[model samples]
Target: MTSPEEALQQARATYEEHARTCRQCHFDAVPCPVSKHLLRAYNNARREQMRANSGVR
Candidate 1:
């Protein structure tokens, strides 16, 4: 299993890469469907990492 930190890093990288290449994400106030999904994933990963650091389940 990937560590929480690694997972968060991967999720962040994926979201950042998509945001960089996706014109809709850059130009539109609302994110595109894929961008939304990626953002959710990144957020989830961040939360997981925080929980892990705090020793919470």
Candidate 2:
């Protein structure tokens, strides 16, 4: 089972990768709000999955 911290870090890296591409696509324009939201959502999902798998109720 993956630790929550590891999962979260992985999620953050994914977000950062998207952010980089988004920034480039937009020419460093307005911040990528969607990417930020996605980051949080993914992290939350990972946490929930971890809890479910760990039988942590």
Candidate 3:
């Protein structure tokens, strides 16, 4: 298994890549409230994963 820090780094990298792709394709930055909601959901999930892996309980 990977360390928590490593996992967080990978997640950050993935989020950046996805955001970049969205910017290129949508060209509106946020595009729409619905899309923003989905992006926020993804960000929340990443945060949850980080907390789970950090062993802070």
Candidate 4:
């Protein structure tokens, strides 16, 4: 029952926390794979939502 916006906010918060605790020297920042993965996931979810909504109309 949770809205997508709420879920995204939760995800963003979690990402922020991870970034804060992330080891810079141990890992790359600008090219972080986590951000790339999350972006793909978000795009997929948005596409699915649009597809479902279009079908409903």
Best by TM-score: 1
- TM-score for each model: 0.89, 0.48, 0.48, 0.48
Using lDDT as the yardstick, the better of models 1 and 3 is 1
lDDT of model 2 at position 33: 70
- Residue lDDT tens for model 3, 1-32: 86555665666666656666775436766555
Q: lDDT of each prediction vs. the true structure?
A: 0.92, 0.73, 0.62, 0.59
After superposition, the stretches of candidate 1 with alpha carbons farther than 4 Å from their true spots are none
RMSD of each: 1.2, 4.6, 4.4, 4.3
By TM-score, the better pick of 1 and 2 is: 1
The TM-score between candidate 1 and the true structure equals 0.89
How big is the positional error of residue 22 in model 1, measured in Å on the Cα after superposition?
1.0
Shift of residue 20 alpha carbon in model 3, Å: 0.8
In TM-score terms, candidate 2 sits at: 0.48
Which candidate comes out best when scored by lDDT? 1
Model 3 Cα displacement at 53 (Å)?
A: 10
Q: Note the residue pairs that clash in candidate 3.
A: none
Which is the better candidate, 1 or 4, if ranked by TM-score?
A: 1
